[model samples]
Target: MAQPSLSMIVEGMIKADSPKPEDGWTLGWDVVVSYSEEEINKNLASRWEKHRDEMIKEIETQMTEERRPGESSDEEDERPTCDIKLELGAPRIQFVSATTSPTVNLLLPVRKGSSKWSDKQKTSILPENSYQICLKNIPLGTVKGNYEEIQDKNRSGKLPNPTTGEGECRFENRVPDHDPSKFEVSWVVLDFSMKEGDLNVQGQMAPGCELDNVEDGKTKVRLARGLKVVKSAAEAFFVGTRETKFSPVFNVLRHALVTVKNKELPQQVGGSRNLTPKKFRMASLKGSEVKPILSLFIHVVDGVDEGESRDLQTRWGGLWLNTKEDVMAPIPSTHTASILIHPKLIYKDVLSRSLASESNKGWRFKQLVGVEGGGIALHAALQCEFRMPSIRLQFDKGSGRIQVTVDDWSKDLKELPATIHLHQRAMDERPVISVNWKFSTETRRTNSRSEKVHPALDVYKEVTGDITRWKTTFKLAQDVPMKTNSTDYDITLEPDMGKLSQCWEITEEEGETDVWDKIKNFFRVAWLSNDEVFKDLVVESKESMRKMIPGFKLGEMGLGFFLTTNLLNPGAKVIRIDKDVGFRAPGNLLLVGHVIQGTDEVKSGKV
Candidate 1:
């Protein structure tokens, strides 16, 4: 299929265990991040060691308070010497595909916290001996289990003698319940929608438990009645964990995406800038049946008028594929994607706005010709007013460069109004001499009745007779070499001043002059054309032209808007840009690049 004039397509695959259905999975999506049992336990152990002292003190204080005033407090004395250990088995996550909900299960073994005190004195307890502490039977509504006591020789208050037997006591570890359903907690169902300029998400609990009863022949387990209450309590736990542990991360991601989509470009007074997805779908490709591919179509529209009518489907018609054959075509293996840009977006939307900005229109200067007493002080003021010029970009496949041509420089270039004044001193307000001149395209004039007097002719009429009419013409054309860099999508076009070819032609019709007078006028024209004199004038003219219309660094011109508005992702850095595809393609400009993900934080704000 042909590429679009303006659009972006991103294609990638998700490796799944089962083959994707032809119709595709459209109910919802699931994302699971898993950690191994050893890794989770290692992290927990480190944290537990750091706060073990504080936790033991808190537990002892609580246990002491729970004892009645008259009850025996002998068991509390051994609590201070007990050692606590926490063990958690690997966790499992279950995602309900139909409802797009999540359920988490964790295994927690119960062990006895304390053992009965023997008749032996407390002083006999060896400092090297360790005791296991068990938490109370908290009555977990979802899972049921019994605490088991540790069997060891130390229970008889006699530490094993190093010379007689093994120096350490042995305690058997309790086996935890492995039934996943007993420890499962289901989260609320969440729904998401993107519309207008906002991302909206809403979550609610299921009306009732779907797995309530087990029916066998004419008998029902009747366990669902109690299970319903337990499920409600689990839902509350899920909500608490989501709010405390996951909501902040989710909010940050949503804010970042929405901010980039709705960001407004600078100097966008009459139009709007928007970044939105055109299409997003999940489907299986030909060779990768088990690996479903995700195709996301995104587009950027900048400086579009508020109420303008735009048919995006027609404008981007070439990007769409209609049949299975076209959709199943082998995707590009390279890690790159193209960005097609229309000419209007560059010339009208970007360059025109930058040139017409108030900050870059005109300049002023003052200089003294000589240092001698009050040597001809000269001051000049110039201003430019111009219409945007038409430009063409031709990509050369061999050189990998774009030939930028400006066919008729005079057509769009307006005359520059320059006013110069001569003063004897810096403090003088009124100048001794003042001249008003205009630099522009050449002209012609004749004394014939049919020909009108040129504006420039009037300026010289006081010195030369009206009968002595003159004609002048200028021809200007330029071809600049533009180099494209893929790194930042920058296009560099700086034309050499010497290569900007121009020609000036001047002729005069001396209507009624004698031989000697005509001879003098001829010498005057010859003097003006001398190589030494003309070279200086041409050099000065080129200098002024450079100031009037400066060269362009289009890379910044295109991306400056996004940077200023904080639209681009802070965590992604452009590593390499690929313009070869664009040069080979039929579009005016195409750009592709690779970006490396960083750990930068995304700032949030309304665009």
Candidate 2:
């Protein structure tokens, strides 16, 4: 047999100015439920009787309407199929946990007071003017039909119900039960200190509170068994503050009263978890901490599915008074699990800009706030273009070539081709530079009248030039081109006299006289410097000085040679003969060209 439903019994005391309370209070909730058979039970038989009458009426009306304004309503043989219900029971309540042990019962303190107060007195009464409130959880249980057995028997023909229409039907009900072994019964009593006009209590009362169990046909429990009172004072002190003028008490005490007369009620009877007001208040010079608390019960009706289990699990959830780490208390038996989380930021954003100068054109970046790792690594692509120093060059239109030999100049020339074509040059006070075009292929749109047929050219050229040659080319372009007729091209091609015999330079080395000669010939042909011959003469004179004197300083010998000859001259040569002392040259070889060391330097002349 299913266990009978349990109910709560409440008894309390309160002031006269409060709502009238019933004997006790109880709340009903389903822990497990069978399908709702209320409609099937309430209207099965009654509905069939009504359907029979309606069908007869409808058939008669249709028959009458079908006639030509004069039809007989004689065909009323049809009967309704539905039936009125003979049995319907009210919904029942189920306990969160079932009682496995027969001796299961609820235990609570007969008196509502703190442990500290209980130690002082087994039973204590409130002050004459003080308000008293009480709250506690009540135990309740439910009863339901054995639906599984009912269904099984129906399949076995123990219960008879028609498979087709126009017959009686049977339904199975699945009820919930509480396992007493699964629950820990404890009472949490709240004694509120409420002030006047601050507490409000409302409820329903039958033929007055004087009714017996059967006075009114309805089952009822006393919500606030006797009365609920609210108390507060405009001018109140913190304990003994009223007797001490130097006390730092600033705020008054606010209190409310709640009476608990039931033992098996759900949280719906208790209202919300946070019932305390959150109004800000000013404290005295010596501030005091305010700790707010909320209390509620968690009801875990047994035999519920996963969804209902999870939904009902959050019987109490909100901000607790303690930090998450400190809230290490064990979870209550009423819930599957409990979690307290504290979320915070890892890092903050630092707004800043690039550190390098604008000329560098190198992109710099800063880290965003709270990205990841200690330092986030990010990669982004940057494309930048900048202008290089301008190089202007003038070219000779005849040869259409600007020849230049540059040294010690470093610029990016990888993108430039070996040869360039000159088209334009810039002019300014600064010396001109010759720019050479590096050819490339590109497609560029052309402005056209017809939108459908846009045109483009496939040619791109860049200019690069050396500074000295750039200036010379610019000057040459400014002057008229030296004329050389096509017929006299050969004659004009012959090396110019001024350039043909120009001496070139050669440097001394440990070896390679032959190399020097080859280099001299090549450079002289090109009208380069005359240093090659100078190097040769210097090498020979040093040998001569070594032979004439032992252990002679190389620096002294170099100086001596410079004094004896214009060492800067590449065409210079020492006069000597085979087994002979002197050989004569045509021109003077004075060290300073006669102008510096001539006899009193004959009349100064200007070039």
Candidate 3:
């Protein structure tokens, strides 16, 4: 009650500027306050002067009674004291962009847990609870293209440009059309911050650091101790003639920042904020890729080998593909006139479809042209402009069927065209050209069910001619779908060869036709008894690779047909026949179709 000795009155004082949980920098505890014990004694000296003598004598006697020979006491404790300590709080988090020329400003959301503080002031206090940070703003970035940078003024708005010394590598004197192994990069910088009151730090503050490196000329940074950055999409690193043509670096980085943040992330906190932080999700690691389908320009000559067996598989002629771009010396003069002309061949739709699945965002088809001398060029005309829902090509040797897997399951029919070229000279050899037709044994079904499904093969002559001028023998299968209900069909003979062409429909139409013509044409009869007076009849073959073609068909219901044709002098020996499947189910059913298109090769001799 006697004011307890003045020496015992003072305790400790709290330091003001403590770091918050959201702050990016570190805080070390070393703050201190000085207490003036000597000063206080001097200021009160006059007032206690009279008793000073007695006080000194009594103090000296008590001090002497408690003193050891060489011990030094804490003088301030015996006199007066003032203490200093930082107010406890959490550290804040900040965003650090890998690139110097960062183009965008973004805010990462922080998931803070319930604070164990006694009051509001204590809530912002440091070392209270650790919070998780996440961001869900814009796309990861663009590839191979330039982009503008964006900044947010409210939070560390300073944008980073091409950071110095982050020298972009460029390969000098590389091969022609060769891309540099390295890349030029520009990035936008972002700084994240937090006020002391907003953070509740807990657990040992995590240690972190980052470093950058270059591989094959491209710049890449490594983080030693921090969250791994993930991209939402696949990014290309190398961009010479191969790898990727675009700036995949930015794509990967942007996707990492945006996509990863939007999804649920893993939580590292507990208690009132027990809601676990969502896990960070990443795109598949297989990455984006594409494959090329090949096209070969070949030339064939008869009489190269005249030994073995088999007519179609004979050992007479040899085939030559233009491995070199420029034309080779024309076949030796001797073989020139006798040269059975057949040039160019393609492995139709022969690339894996799965490779196109992941990179469907910008799916494209390309023709791989690898010359004998290593010269390569890509033709866009051969590229597939869009991705199918499903990417599968099916061919069964036993069934003699080909099925192309489509992405859309609703439609069972896919229309494809077949076009063959006949050299102008080949048409001059034979007067009356004959066409031989063949069919595959495989039957098509839809959704695993083969009920009444008759594959149809309907052929229409391309030349326009008088209906009565043409004579031909053909059967209308009852299973072929048509607008009309007819059983027998045939062609009639006309006087001139031109007349036969008149009855030929030249327009490119799909298997289905209008109701009027469908019914009208179905009943037409084939004229197989007419006299043959034509010579050297020829149809030219296409010079380019076989592209999808268009055509029309005449059909009768309840029947299906497959047709093959042989000219007087068959241009190419074998008409590589294959089936095309338009639809497929997991089990036994497959909706099959055909991609009949002209080959780039032209046949020079009679069929």
Candidate 4:
């Protein structure tokens, strides 16, 4: 009974004629598991002594913090209860596939190389449908005979998987045995190239049915996009496949799912009786040849109604690389002209009980750089405010609203806090725009109070025409009087039109449409709003701002911004002169809107 040398396997059944084959008999039902319990022959009473010290320490600390309170818990005197159950559920759909599109490789250079940059090489993609979409499935078997073969192959293994080594994967497809109604999705395996959040697009069904690619020679088409919904657990099934460079790219555009069969197939002489959901599509052709892939379309077709609470999952994700799909040549063309650029701000902030800790706010500005080269560059600076709860809400009550607040309110917003500073010193201005958000935010501040004199105000000239019908709500902020470098003058102020609509383009009816006065005011104020010392260098300037910068200590901060009197203030922060912003290279330099941020570092360094 206690022999390690003697080994035996029980197989024969007590019933007679059990070995006889039958249609209802399961050939795989003969598997048995061996259990071990050598320690049962020894004593377990002494094992508790080994953990006795740790047990006592835990018990002693349980009452330390809560002992001061009179409240008690029933768990303290009586041990808590535990319930264990072994409920079984059906397995979910699981599939694995592979695809290739050389265009997906284009993202590598963009992600690895320095962004917002250009080289001698042209950014292009390989022909679209040139790459084949190869999908192979994994097989599932429970037969002892087949399992034994699999073990033998692995022992003399040239590869871990022998079935896929020479043959394809096959599985029996089945049907749902439950109800339908609710939906829940979760990812057991998540890999994202550029996923922002939840599933905005799945399969070919995108939000708003955007166009994916052109077909009628030259008609406009929407860009194809995809997002992941969920992933399954590895234990749900073992998945093994070759690693491909285009690994996640295929999933970003397409996906696979498992489903049950509606009816059983007639078990033929060679084929099994299982059925699976199958999908296929034809690729578009170009002039008798398959054209290179330019975009993707993600579509999802409902194939299973496995009852209430269906789960959608697949292994999905992509590598990081900004999405840019335009071609810009050395010379300008129709596509290169009048390009519309949209800026997106990504905010990252922390909420906390303390006002000082909560004020830490920052944002990331990301966009695909255009080829037009005339697009505006951007920089950000901001001051944050956080308001705490007030006790006054508890006393005043006609409203059923709960007026809870934080302990303190952060910095004041009256000073025009968030600003996107426009550094308009040159035209060849594609300066590398990586900024330390904290440092850049603090760099905008000056020791003198007049530095914040709203720049947008200087351009909104007093209305010469009749405005009796206009409400006071439309007018900008009031003016402020500040003296700088022995020059005392009142500089007009205006709220940031960024928070409102601002007209920078001029069309017909200048007075009725062009708010150039309102739009240009901020730059004038920002020019003069320099520090106390630089306020002197800008005093009734005879020479240009750029020429004088190299000779002075403050030149390192970059030049061109100077503000004096109304007549003396430069027309705009953006000025054209040789060597503008003191750039050493020869290229088209551009500056765009600026963003204001807050930082602990005050002194200016290379941003």
Q: Clashes per prediction?
A: 3, 52, 106, 53
* Candidate 4 lDDT tens digits, 259-341: 11122222211221121112111111011111111110111112121111111111001100110212211111111100000
Rank order (by TM-score, best first): 1, 4, 3, 2
Per-residue lDDT of model 3, residues 1-607, tens digit only: 0111111110000011211211100011010001111221222222222221121100000001133568576553342211111211111212122223211222221111222222224422122111122222222121111112222212232223323221211212332344454222222111222222222222222222112221422212221111121111101111111222433332222211100011222222111011111111100000011011011111111111111122211111111112121111111111110001111111111111211334322223343322111111122121232121322333232213322221221211122111111111121121111111111111111111011223353222222111211111111111111121111111111112222222322221124346765454444311111212111010110101011121122111121111001110111111121222111111101111111223333211100
Tell me the lDDT of model 3 at 406: 18
As a whole number from 0 to 100, the lDDT of residue 2 in candidate 4 is 18
Q: For model 3, what is the alpha-carbon lDDT of residue 501?
A: 21
Query: Stretches of candidate 3 above 4 Å error?
Result: 1-185, 188-529, 532-607
Q: What is the lDDT of residue 597 in candidate 4?
A: 18
Best by lDDT: 1
lDDT of each: 0.25, 0.17, 0.18, 0.17
Candidate 1 residue-wise lDDT, 1-607, digit = tens? 2222211221111111111211011111110111122222233333233322321111111111135578686764543221222221111111111211211122111111221123323321111101122111211111111111222222333222122111111111321454332221111111121222222211111112122222342222222322222222222222222223322322211101111111233322233222222111111121221111111122222322211113322212212233222232212334322233332233344334333444434533333222222212223333343432433333222222222222224322223332222222222111122233333432221111111145444221212211232222222322222332232323321222233322222222324567786676566445333434333443443343344442221122232222211111211222244444322111112334433333333221110
Residue 463, model 3, lDDT: 22
Give each model a TM-score: 0.28, 0.13, 0.15, 0.16
Judge candidate 3 at residue 53 and give its lDDT: 18
